[model samples]
Target: MRRRISVAETAPTQPGTTGSFTTGEWWRDAVIYQVYPRSFADGDGDGMGDLRGIEERLGYLSELGIDAVWLSPFYRSPQADGGYDVADYRDVDPLFGTLADFDRMLQTAHELGLKVIVDIVPNHTSSAHPWFVEALESPSGSPERARYLFRTGTGAAGELPPNNWSSVFGGSAWSRVNDASGEWYLHLFDTSQPDLNWRNPEVVDEFKSILAFWAERGVDGFRVDVAHGLIKHDELPDFEGITGEMLEGGGNRGPMWDQDDVHEIYRGWNEVLKAFDGDRMLVAEAWVAPAERLSRYVRADEMQQAFNFDFMTVGWNAGRMRDSIQSALATNRAVGATTTWVLSNHDVVRHASRFGLSDPSAWPKGISATDEQPDSALGVARARAATVVMLALPGSAYLYQGEELGLPEHTTLEAELRQDPNFWRTAGVDIGRDGCRVPLPWKGDAPGFGFGPSGSTWLPQPASYSELAADRQDGDPLSTLELYRRALLLRRELQLGRAELSFNASTGDTLDFTVAGVRVLANLGAEPVELPSHHEVLLVSDDAAVDAGQLNSNGSVWLR
Candidate 1:
């Protein structure tokens, strides 16, 4: 039942000629790897990951078989929200590298045959940004103020916030300014990040220029941060209920979150992307609800792809996962856009740890040492199985940097060392995203695990990281890193990304599907499932799980 398939011998049709594949549509089924600059690798020995770090590691990504690299924001910032609060859209943060360093990195990534997609935070900018500083100095009705959402307070003597909207991090979304204007600015995220008034033609044109600046520098695409939040209702209204985290998409979002007008902005952005020579693309980080509404962001004239948050947040159960997949595919098919699947990212808990939780759904905000601990061994097994299933699906896929190494979150990070604004803003109720953003361990015994020469990191690494370092797993056949290498190689060889998928008969606790003549069986039940007859195994999450004709619990296998 366990058989190794030769990737070199496979000659499946290329993705360029298959399902949803049109001429020059490389993004339709590309495998993009997300690099959190602060954690990927440290090249300057400055205790932080930088552009130089990314450039030096380009070969690692190339060998990993990813089609593109999606780097989180490295724009000039005060590090208010870990670079999400950008101070200057055109320049690189000194903490990351100079503009020249970014250009070099872009050139290197392109040379490696990997497209580059940089993060663009259009919804808000850091308070340190010149526009925001000028807006603060100008009077309430001044043109500088018009570029941002500055409004008079609502209460007697203008003491209360303009509306009842809450910040996604915590507290009121409105931040009062102590100045002659005495006006309050809106910020859906951290206080340092003031929301840009999309209604202002100046703001709209400025973002278009910013996009062109990067595209001209040869960045293949952009991942629009808070893509659904650029637009808001003209009448700033109060929410019907409490708004703890607006990014959690479901049901009907309130006025400030996912307004219908947001798509208009993207439609215009699409025009900008089309003007570029390369197939420059736009990917929405929108957390909009109902698969149908989410699809609207990826229409032919709009963005090409949007992160499938629904699939990432789905529980480990097979029934829910199956439903999520079916719904996503059907909606994207209607829009003629490729579906992008993601299981882990910089924001959420790594799937490696999430899968081991007693309540896997409870840790999106994050987990702490004081909280319920995950069963690490069990989590790794389930995560591997889940990845195999995700890789076999049609369309594009995103891999969080350390996921292939089975790196778990630093769940025990102490409070004093935490840096995410979510932790401070929420008054410690939310542990924040720091645990998942810890520096990567590259070597088993090297200082700082070869993350940097200085052997220091912004966030502390757990002792367990040493065992899972990349060097330790590099050539080990049974390692998670090798498994990913093999899986990605086979995925490309079989053209699974361009293959159509069909559901097969299976019990509630199991998922059975076929893609390009290859059958994928995932056993999420408590017991093993018998394999289908007359099929040779191509790959498996765990070799021990496949024996005779049975696949063990929380295991997955591919057959042909």
Candidate 2:
């Protein structure tokens, strides 16, 4: 419906032995780990986390050399906002289990080669979804209340709320409908959820039949949820001075968000993910703004990837991380697409306590045990030098579940065991996202550290998560889960996700570059630097004092 295509010969390249084009679309440069399924791994001991606790942690995400896992929303939810309020995009959520435990956890994450990706909210549902309880007993403009965004109310007699759009978990984004037939629905997040109507064709054949019922049950893609808010602005306008600041990407041209009819609903969800043959992908948690309008949701045909969030909201400087990775590789190379890189997810702050606080751009939207605590050993040394500069940056890199055990953000959570709807829609003075959604500790020392087997953890795992447990840094070679398992096994023995980075001439506060030719560096100065004339170190977030040639200060290297 919006056709502006050119996917560069159906995109997928990855064969590289050094020639540098790299897209064998295994999500082009794949490292993707995210999880957050009720705080990953609780296998039936039931402190939550299920799907047989992610099939007993698919061998700990295939020994952390992750190639794909995503998860985040075990569907059928009533967990209000945690599961992003969904209600049944075809089942699961008996608190996460069954559809035969999600086909035995997608057949053990495709027998451990991994690739799962799930989470597809489609801009709202779960007002107890039976089509929102039959559009709350239908009749308003019936057709079962035209699949959602209900309307019909605008002041006195009708009683206000047909405009001034708000609620991203705060207040008035419509709601009203309790009978008297005065109607009003919308819900840009939580009045139990609602909001569907993408100009309803029965909400586009019920999400293309919920994306062919999870791509015929193999599910290799779809992170969508609020992917640029499903088509709005046909009229309901009235947004002046809406300082919700477009939820942080800050440009705020909000007509209920990035809506060029939401790229014809992602080119009809990239034709339901190219009718699945398993190369399937989708990625857009689109908080769209100056980040080159997220390259029209990864255009070529639509959504092949979209989550740079301007390199996860830039600011741990080095010329603002090389101008936000050269404006996200010139806006995803103007649409050929594939440039993901992330740092911290489950909605923010755990770039190891936002790189030890002191105003890492005032991270706000919730974080307050009287705030200012950060600096836990300088936030695990700049979150281990920002995960070796986001896994040597070339393309895909997601990793959020416990940040490979470098966990951090439990920023003092306790307002009655808080649970994020941005802190009950700001009633508690915004201390939400339950300190980066706590819960994963995995193994000994107390209180569900093992996250189940009845240790019982539904968010409170702190005491410094017993030294970032995963059985105390699984074979700690100076841990951070063995530096993300030796930088994802040297990012696959140096294919470096199909390599090609470049940059080089940097000096103060380091960050030099190179990728196919390897190099990398980083420092972001406070101290050490001098490195270059390489030949081999391959990976080193901090080899205990690493300096025969320097690089330390918040360290990160990769040389070769």
Candidate 3:
């Protein structure tokens, strides 16, 4: 009883035929691949990855089928907060490369037709920055001290600085200036990374100038870091109803977190950034839920994209994933805006490792004896499924580096090696994101894993992934790397996964949908189930099979 698929079938475009989609037009259906430069690939033997390393691997990215590459910070800094606290905006860190090397990397990226976006930390600066140093050494805070919120002290009145907002990494958000005067500075992140004062007009100009500097050099847009923590409540105000800020004055300042008018400051950047993003594509790390509240960032005029972290914390069940998508998607539509979905980044443990696909425990089994490896078959399949799900959803999709090749995380911890402020505060709990940020294995059973000189990488390459080296698997048809190559080709070839998804829900953790005339059905169950009779099966998971008239799966099915 074969039933015809009603939708018209259009001829598909083969992979790489779009040649390489420019990051501008690529924003619509684009899948952004995020790369943390320090761990990606090393061109020099300096024990760290740099631009030249990236330039050598441009073809690999193109093959991965990402529309853009969102590279993490490489700006000059003291390595406090891993380059988030930038001292010089224009120059590359010596460990990373020179301006000439970066220019070549950008050029190579463009030549491959991939858009490039770098991390922009707007909220803070390294205390060692010229501006911050000048402010600190001066008898009185310099005029540029206004560039940051320089407060001698705020009366601990009004809801106690608005409900006493707690600092992210522990302790108070306020850091004291060790100058002749006892002035307090705001630092929502690390004390060394002091927050900038966006209220100051010059501060806005300086930030906007940085945007212009990159956009002029052909970068598509920026992945703005800690974007929501920009302009916080002024005058040390109390919370609306609550007596004070949330957990304020434990040796910290009150108004260290969210302020209402930060949106206005964002609007100014929105105006300036429009010229760079073709779709005005600036992605904010606005780490908040409730689209209505976060909608202000994408308010018909602000950010083109913000991190859709709703899905980050969700589970493996269909109902859970669906709700995560519905909230972010439906909410954005209601606000007449859009957002992007990202599962993993440099700040968190890799999703593969977290979900037990890479290992039995949530922590990475990095280069160590205690570390347990992933269920290989299960892990690779799960990674592919994650990619499929991400691409099929609406808005933009983000794929973390090495994720395309089913890269497992490296999570060994050395006693003297703990750097994240969280471990010190949380008492050995999960704090630093060391596992996901390890070096990318590129050659040999591992060629220094291609991250740096032999034995010189910032983090050790996991023994588990030596065989998964990018070079070894590149041409092998059966390699997980090849599977991703095919997946990327299929994603662009069909162009169906990039569109808005319309779901048909009847509860019961059931998800059914259609993409370009192909029917997709997933039943997160443990028993056999019969799907509607008309569809023809393209693939199925578990022991289920498509026979005669009925489709069966306890997992998933793609049909036509």
lDDT of each: 0.87, 0.77, 0.66
Q: Which stretches in model 3 have alpha-carbon errors above 4 Å?
A: 1-19, 22-25, 139-142, 153-165, 237-258, 276-280, 357-380, 424-427, 453-455, 475-479, 528-557
Against the true structure, whose TM-score is highest?
1
Q: How many clashes in each candidate?
A: 0, 6, 18
Q: Write the per-residue lDDT of candidate 3 for residues 404-468, one digit (tens) a residue.
A: 66776665657356555545544544346666777788875545765666647876666767787
Ranking by TM-score: 1, 3, 2
TM-score on alpha carbons, each prediction: 0.95, 0.34, 0.84
Task: Answer with 1 or 3, whichever has the higher lDDT.
Answer: 1
lDDT of 1 at 352: 93
Q: Model 2, 336-365: lDDT tens per residue?
A: 786888878887778777778886545565
Count of clashing pairs, candidate 2: 6
Q: Positional deviation of 197 in candidate 1, in angstroms? A: 0.3
**Worst 10-residue lDDT window, candidate 1:** 11-20
Question: Candidate 1 vs candidate 2: which has greater TM-score?
Answer: 1
Q: What TM-score does model 1 achieve against the real structure?
A: 0.95
